[model samples]
Target: METKVIINEERCKSCSLCVSVCPKNVLRISNRLNPKGYHPAELFNNDECISCGFCYLICPDAAIVEVRRPIKVKS
Candidate 1:
């Protein structure tokens, strides 16, 4: 199974809660600022992400979402 992390940049409040709770260290504060003048969180290392949902759960602004793609079954 593969997992993808999607960040709603506009909604992010630049809080590090998501980054700190992420076990995989997949999230980081971006250098660029959002429209709200906040350094939104970004996915830095998606390959290492286990999709534990810690980041999503910890985000206060509902900025992060994890999507788990179904693994393909070979006949």
Candidate 2:
């Protein structure tokens, strides 16, 4: 299984809530500011993400979204 983290850069407030909640430590606050003048959260290393959706759940601004995709079986 694979998970994709989608962040709405403009909506992010750099609250760091998602970054702290993520168990896999996949998210981090970026140094660059977004159009909204906020340092949005970014995915640093998604390989460790378990599709836990903690980032999405913790984001108060609804900026984070997680998509889980099942890996195809090769028989």
Candidate 3:
């Protein structure tokens, strides 16, 4: 599955605000550290992501670069 939430690992500061605000718990702090020496946030469950943009809004550093929700089609 394609990731709806795109996070800039290098820009993340290990803040869990995005993780806390995520409704689906799709985002999590990665075990590996980034260039800045902080654990970056990563998309763990692409299928569960709802693309509500809560994570993006809560990220103070704007680590979440993009949020693309699937467009529903009318049947």
TM-score-wise, the better of 1 and 3 is 3
Clash count (model 3, backbone only) = 0
TM-score of 3: 0.90
**Taking the tens digit of each residue's C-alpha lDDT, what string does model 1 give over 1-75?**
344787889999998998888877788899999999999999887778777788888888888865554566899
C-alpha lDDT of all candidate models, in order: 0.82, 0.82, 0.90
Q: What TM-score does candidate 2 get on C-alpha atoms? A: 0.84
In Å, residue 73's CA in model 1 sits off its true spot by 3.7
Q: Cα RMSDs of all predictions? A: 2.3, 2.2, 1.4
Q: Ten consecutive residues with minimal summed lDDT in candidate 1?
A: 64-73
Candidate 3 lDDT by residue in tens digits, 1-75: 678988889999998999998888888899999999999999999998888999989999989999998878799
Positional deviation of residue 12's Cα in model 2 after best superposition, in angstroms:
0.2
Name the top lDDT candidate. 3
Q: What stretches of model 1 exceed 4 Å from their correct place?
A: 1-3, 70-72
Model 2's number of clashes is 0
Clashing pairs in 2: none
